[model samples]
Target: MRVLTILLCLLLTGTPARAVQPDEVLPDAALEQRARDISAELRCLVCQNESIDDSDAPLARDLRLLVRERLVAGDGDREVTDFIVARYGEFVLLRPVFGLHTALLWLGPVIVLAFGAVALVRGARRRRQEAGTPALTPEEKARLDAILGQD
Candidate 1:
């Protein structure tokens, strides 16, 4: 039973199935690796969340082929990536480049965090102030005492 469980775990956690076909694999090992690396960084437009390497979508296949084609054409990694970015826009990149255009994407989290921290600090200060002092003024307290005495 333990051996069966171990086998199941190994099968489940083993290398994930890739979408790359045997025909799609380049003969040149180095170029094929580069193509694969590039494919892994490209987002599949159809899948939206999956990389081209993992997605079975036709667009992902096209992108994979395009990457291989670019490699075969002697384009460097950066050049191939630039070409894809130009053709498909930066949204196709799994990891987007930080620049003026993508500034919000890169900085929005930090900005939100900073704003939340400021709000938290302000909230803590307000809570401390409230805890330190009486909620009512001296006159109000005197009025309350008089009312209670009358009652």
Candidate 2:
């Protein structure tokens, strides 16, 4: 049983998944650096939370290649980004532009936090008001006293 468990664990954990090959790397260090920089800022559309540089998706590799190609073609960083934005809207950027279209993306978290603070303050105030109210009538107080007296 122990050998079977070990075999199962090895089967699950030991196999190496396919990743990008070393031969696919760019020969130019400067282009490679530019690719890395651009990839770091670009969101991987397939893996929404990860940057293109860190994502293993084929689309991420394509984006990396695109950035490198643009850099090699004498385009500046902004030009490369502009090209991508033109192709895939502003949503592809990790830090979206500030405009009517993207204002909510920039402000959504702040608005939620402000609302939460207001709600929390109101709740605490309500609790305090309830706590400060008179505890009991004379009869209720007498019953409470009697109950305590027994203890």
Candidate 3:
């Protein structure tokens, strides 16, 4: 039981294996670190939600290589990111930039919610108004009562 517990603990506590292969590692520690930071910000196109740093997909590997290449070519972090964004479109970044182009993406849900709330309030008010007043006129009420043999 103790051996099993120890194995379980090791398994749970072990650091996750990185997807970057040994051949892909940069010689310069600083550049490698920057590449890692950039990779973490980039979405793996094939893996959807996973960052390129964590993804094991072939596209993720290619993206990692591209980042290293850009860094070696003396591109600044922003420039590297922009290059990727230009090639893959805005979806390459895990967090999209807030700008005129993306304003609708950021605000669309709130706008939809506001419209839904207005429609809901209007519908409730209409239902309440409909339910509050009786439809029968005095003559209609009298006729209904006479048909039911009520004096």
TM-score of 2: 0.69
| Candidate 2 lDDT, 11-126, residue by residue in tens | 98885442334654678887777767887889888987788877789997788778778888999999999999899888799988899987888899999999999999999999
Over 54-127, each residue of candidate 1 has an lDDT whose tens digit, in order, gives 99988899999999999999999999999999999999999998999989999999999999999999999999
Ranked candidates (lDDT, high to low): 3, 1, 2
Clashing pairs in 1: none
For all predicted structures, in order, the TM-scores are: 0.82, 0.69, 0.70
Which window of 10 residues has the lowest lDDT sum in candidate 3? 129-138
In order, the Cα lDDT scores of the candidates are 0.94, 0.82, 0.96
Once fitted onto the true fold, the runs of candidate 2 whose alpha carbons sit more than 4 angstroms away are 1-21, 133-151
With a 3 Å backbone cut-off (N, CA, C), the pairs that clash in candidate 3 are: none
Which scores better on lDDT, 1 or 2? 1
Please identify which of the two predictions, 2 or 3, would achieve the higher TM-score against the true structure: 3
Better of 1 and 2 by TM-score: 1
- Candidate 2's displacement at residue 108, Å, is 1.5
